[model samples]
Target: MSRVLAFPAGRRAKWLVLVAWLIILGAAAPFAGKLFGAVENDRLGYLPKSAESTAVLEQQEAFPQGRVNPAIIVYQRDGGLTAADRARAADDQRWMAGKYMPKTPPPPPTVSKDGKALIYQIALVAPPDKQEGNYVLDAVDAMRKHIGDPGGGLEVKVSGPAGRDSDQFLIFRDMQYQLVLIPVIVVAILLLVIYRSAVLFLVPLFTVAVANQLGSAFVYGLIKNTDLVINSMSTGVLSILIYGAGTDYALLLISRYREELARHEDRHEAMAEALRRSSGAVLASGGTVALGLLCLFAADLNATRALAPIGVLAVGSAMLAMLTLLPALLVVFGRWLFWPRAPHVGDSKRAHGFWTRMGETVQARPRRVWALTSLGLAVGVLGLLAFNVPQQTQFTTTPDSERGQTLISAHFPAGNGNPATIVANAAQADQVKTAATGSGVVGAVAEVGRAAGKVQYAATLNAEPVTAAERSAVHRLREDVHAVNGAEAKVGGPAAIQLDQRDTNVRDSWITIPLVLVVIFIVLLLLLRAVTLSVLLIATVALSFGAALGVSTLVFEYGFGWSGQDSQLPQLAFVFLVALGVDYNIFLMSRVREESRRHGTREGVIKGLVTTGGVITSAGVVLAATFAVLVALPVVSFAEQGFVIGLGVLIDTFIVRSLLVPALVHDIGDRVWWPSGLARGTRQRAERGRELAPDKSR
Candidate 1:
């Protein structure tokens, strides 16, 4: 990866070419794609065809589809409906309809019983088809802005796929500002605060910026060649990868530079030694995270599979930067980078009474501490029982929150809001039609037509559309149609779609979670050589994930008033909760196992917690905070995802890693390493490894 871009001698001269090349290439490729309109394809294109996709496409072809784009035009009669208000509303609707505008015929208006709420459903040229209509999002912005004002009796809240895109565009823009700007500002402040030197403080920022540029270019190249579903969230992932991991590497390099300077050695030797010593840890840490992300491939969902490689590329780039560019820059700047307060080479440890006391308490009463922590996590995990899978196609749309949707809900039967369709085929046209209009169902038989080999019917139900009741109706409709004599029927609609998605998600979860756990468990066991330790670590991750999901359910369902989280959220949460959460667990446990070699189990847990706890805690806090920024964005799905992950990190770091693990380690004593053949071997090896590096301390 490092060899993809050559190393240069003079910093300013080298960076100038790098910057120019990136700008030109990044601008050109996407513009070319848009002009040519070539569909982006991926390696997954090679996968075998699925029966589900074939069924879905066959169903889609049966409809002489009405306008697919769903539009919401909300009218707020903030002032009571008067003559003037009514006139203005009528006029606006006429103006929208009269011109040969891009918009399609608006659906009939559904008014509130009290007359304050009014919504007109507008249709778009087409629904969101990936290839042809992505540009519709751009066209829909004009409608939303028109609704933002109070010109007509209706205060329009135009939403659909187009509205979602507009919302996401704005949200991503804001996130880019915060994710990039805040980290830069925070890091700058911390650098100055810690180093008390303006020049040295800026050095890390400069190095990180260059690293980000190259990393982005690499990702852009991959995106061009592959059909990854890169979205706004990719921006945050890239920024964090560069800033968070880059800082850790910079800290290691700068620390070494200071140590060598204080030893009165030259800059080059100091940097070489720092690179040699720190590179192993840096490589191992980055490799662990990259491998953890790769586990997302086990997911049946396209989203996870898409994101996995992007994350790997970004992290891998950071690792390269840490090894090459950072070291080179450190060599160039020398000890003067730490001017003013200057970097120190003395004992790096700082005493903290609070952590020390906490550790001693756990060491004294391990059983009590373990019991309390376990009970707390169990209570939190109970929230998972109420976990609701969101019904909408897009995560941002919610039935309860939008007044336009609520108005639609009231006037239209639940199933009518989004109707499931059935396609029936039989030898006799009458039999197919009979199956299509079969009774004992929630939906009203709205339309029936006979085609060559199939009878198509669009059904709108009497219940709330896409609700549990509506899904039941859809299922019943399919069952009833299939039960008909000499005919076959297939069902598809929003409700049916939900059922399909739910089924897919459940299947994916089962497949991915166990696979990820087994892989991670095996890796940790091999790394540590203790079965008991592996079981404890995996269990901790599982508990942490459950607790996180439970809390997120409360936030999304009750606090934020969202319908529910995205269907894929649980699977995504499990991926992060297990993978990243266990990454920290491994870091903490490795330290603990090292300490356990020297002292007894009770003493070892405490020593490990005291030694590596701060670093792990800091990493967790940063990761959590970075993810928490998702909540501030109005996209409910991403918000739910971010909140779940952020909460997981917080709980894992402060509550589980800091408190629970230590208590369990202390309570178990030698039993913590039991049921594993390598317990004695691990101890012996740890002892020998410690002796080989006796002068160094964690």
Candidate 2:
């Protein structure tokens, strides 16, 4: 038997053996002590202390016990609240208090000016931390039920942290419809287009289903040992990986198999050769992407860090499925995968003249094209400095847009949408009290504590009006609190944490931005075998990144009024910019080098562009569209992420790789690869091949 079917010996065949071992090991993993130990660990809810701990203290001191839960009541009255409406709202509040809350009157209920909106500032009998069995959900549900149907012009509804959180959960549940539907619909369409055979389509998707199961099982096991918060976005991201990477790998394998069939070879030889030709590219591409995701480990935030292993594992599972399950299925199905299309062996030659003509035109005048592309990119990049990152926390939204948003907007100061508490360990009680009364403070409350021979004051701040200015207040509060006589104080709150996040982000960007660039540069140099070419590629990618950020800044800051500096924005941008941008560069430059080696610098540049342009452009379109789907999400942060990354991919394809780099290669001539001995050797070898080939054949 040939090595391909042998399941060892051959590098690609060995993949089958290796993956089989992994599957067996993973299957047996549930019995292992490590897996059980991870599950048994109990450190789940411990979020890392934000670097902005001191700042949070200041904000907390200004707020009412750092608790700002406002219950909203919506009712319409003909003129004033009918005796009926007031009675109904009051009865509903009473019923909620009896059922979930303690039977106590809360702070006076504040009604809206238009007589449509009313807010009741209710206090929980148990502190928020001690609420039982999702008390918030229980209370809200109880409130909704008691609101009594409106007879004429009266209706009542409830909202607050507890209320909104419950609402968020409900929205997430409803989103399950889309989550399930979109992937199924998209995969079905793509599969139909790619395979035209239903059985072939089903095979890859079935493999993905298995990969997803194994991926989730492994992830659940990993999280047992780590303190991680899996956000709602995780499911979407995992789905993308399973569907995207799985289909991409299948395409590669199937395409090669079909090519092998043209030679009329037996299935075994065809499968082995298919694996031999395509596996390197598949592994290279997958490895690069996995490497990019793993870079998230460098982030300090738990959310980003948590994503690191999940992303790595998800892609790794797909890779395993591709290598093992996919190959075995192909062996089982053989030539039938093509069905009506039938497997046909033929040289996979790209049409020559298309890229050659484009290369020739670009080479003819590199300066005009370069200049135009640079100007367009510069204009986009200018939007970066003007952008503002909002601290707004209205991250989730419902399908009923106008109503839910209007109710939320009417009831709370935008900053009150998400308020975090701060506790400062004070050395002296009096000093802590005095500091809590600072001018920026709207209100204050405290819990006295004695631990380690020092008093700890859990000071609460009325952070209702959180703003960029409020963050400064938080900073000033920290300074004032720390300056208290004869006391050491430490601060913590959401706003304070946000401020700390800003500072940490600034520092991390300075460190990681260069590091990312270096990694990308090294990859480019290794791949292209040219220092000048690599440097230019990096420069182009940086420009594309700047442009992408600029576009994101305008959309987020000016268009949508969202905070531009999302917790994950900078790092996510860094990863996408370097990874996706370099992908474009690689696609272009690989063809560029091959064409140049065969055709000389001028003809090669043209040929490379003409040949690779369509493929890279298509790939960019697919990748960009994939990310663009995030805009449909209600969260501003997600919209910004999708738009920015999508724009980056588009810009990298059209402006950087398609236009600017080609011109530069044309303009630079031999110096593009100067200092690279291998490029020179490759060019010489190409010349010898030309000389040796018969004139008629050439």
Candidate 3:
């Protein structure tokens, strides 16, 4: 393992590694640019596989009209629409019908009860051969263009499935570039600040950029050739993960190499020693994260399940680049890369610094420090009670679809535009329709189409979409139709999809959280070679996750004025926080164990804290800042994830790793390393005595 690690830093091998990476980058660059084009943003991609809505979606393809993407053009005049307004609306409707639905015309415009608004429902049938995202984008773009400016005081906007889907597609399309650019910029700035050298930060940044490209290309291949399902959300997260994790690994390796440079004259020897010392932690950290992400395969939601492979590939690419490319680059550049503050052989290492003082403070009041910190974190967990799944579209900025939905809600039924869909046997269609209408929750039911003895019906709900009432209404409707003999009925649509997503999120959280915890515990045990410390570290990270979520909940509701969060937030947040948060603990505890073999446990704790503190904290900040870039996106879910994950990393960096974990280990002493020889305290005592007897020859 040492030979392999050092191979990249060899006098001749360094260039070989660089050349190999350049070749790989060249091959990956073209595929990387095509990754976004392969993203599956269809409605079914976000729904649960076992969901009734998913079944409906599959069955709809057989219908004569196929699956319809409804686009509702809403025109409202506060003082009541004039004859001219009505005429123009009719003309626009005719034009849309002629262009989109040539054979079948959409229903006539419906006036609101208050006579202030009008809505024209246009059914834009999706072509079976075309991609859903692109089709929706083109159709909505044409509709919006045809309508142009309203001219009068009348408001004109597109809403419903087609309009909303187009908006979502637009956000994702725009995000493809922003996700890559913003994270790169964030990592670059943080790296510069942390390194404080003009040239030093570039090596890691370039290495991580290569990792990003490789990850993108790899994911693109999986998505294009395999059964893997990926969405815009998954792609966005993959970009962030590659840069964040890759840069973190780079920081750790480089920091260790710098330390070794002060002791070794040969740059190659310095890098070799650095790699041998730090590679284990880097590999273990990457493994823990990759394994944790693998648990996502247990998720029923397509989007969540897709993240498993995507995340693992990202981590693997990052780990490969950092261990190989970064090491070679550092050796090739030698000590001059650090420039102004470069370390030299025989130079005295700084023994007292900010982290050293922090270690002393922790050592002074171990119990008090941990107790107060634990209390503070526990308080933050109270915010979890406020967590609520968002009932409306998750967007940071309002779009045309949202505006149209608001108008429709004010003037028509709250669920006016987006209606629930039901599929049933044609033999029992009449009975199913009657049952559905009599369910009381459904306002009306109409036959949409029929094919292969299966009939499709559109059921307009009396309740708004994505609410408790809407869920209950869909449930009742399904039950009512299922009671009809030989109907084989199922309920679906926007409301049903949201309900299924919520339920799937809950189930996934239960399964993946425990699985991830187990994976992390096993990794920590193997890495630290101690049982007690592993459990303690997992506990601290778990606490950090809860506190981060709790604080995020409070901020979302009170600070951002958001009513609720994305359904997937809790599960995604937990996986990332536990897996990534434990990384710092691993770095600290591993170093502490090595030092404990030479010094006593208490002294080892201080030494480890002082040694690894800056690099780990810098790593945490870089990771946090990369995630923080998500807040700049237009999607609310991405923003919430960014804020919570970023906050959790900060808490882990500053409080848990720095104060809580160190203080607890200090208070417990050698016993913290139970089941290991270090726990016996005999070796620790001998080492302490040997240290005290040092310099006797002088």
Error of 1 at 635 (Å): 2.2
lDDT of candidate 1 over 65-145, digit per residue (tens): 432333445555655556565566566665554531343454456566676655554444434464323344444555554
Error of 2 at 175 (Å): 2.8
lDDT of 3 by residue, 1-698 (tens): 78987789899999999999999999999999999988887887678768888999899889877777788899999999899999999999999999888888678899998989999888877677877878888899999988888775888999987888898888888778988999888888998898899999999999999999999999999988987678888999999999999999999999889888888899998898889889988988888899989999999898899999999999999999999999998898878899788999878775658998999899999999999999999999999998777545467788999889889989999777789999999999999999999999988888888999999999989987556788888889888998998889999887888788888898889999999999889987777778999899999999999999999999989898776888889899999989899977888887887778777788889989999999999999999999998898877878899999999999999999999999999999999998887899835565676777763211
What is residue 166's positional error in candidate 3, in angstroms?
Answer: 1.6
- Residue 143 Cα positional deviation in candidate 2, in Å, after optimal superposition: 4.9
lDDT of each: 0.62, 0.61, 0.88
lDDT at residue 639 of model 1 (Cα atoms): 76
Q: Deviation in angstroms for 571 in model 3?
A: 0.9
Highest TM-score: which candidate?
Answer: 3
Candidate 1 Cα RMSD (Å): 5.8
Is candidate 2 or 3 superior in TM-score? Answer: 3
- Model 2 clash count equals 23
User: For candidate 1, what is the total of clashing residue pairs?
Assistant: 8
TM-score of each: 0.78, 0.78, 0.96
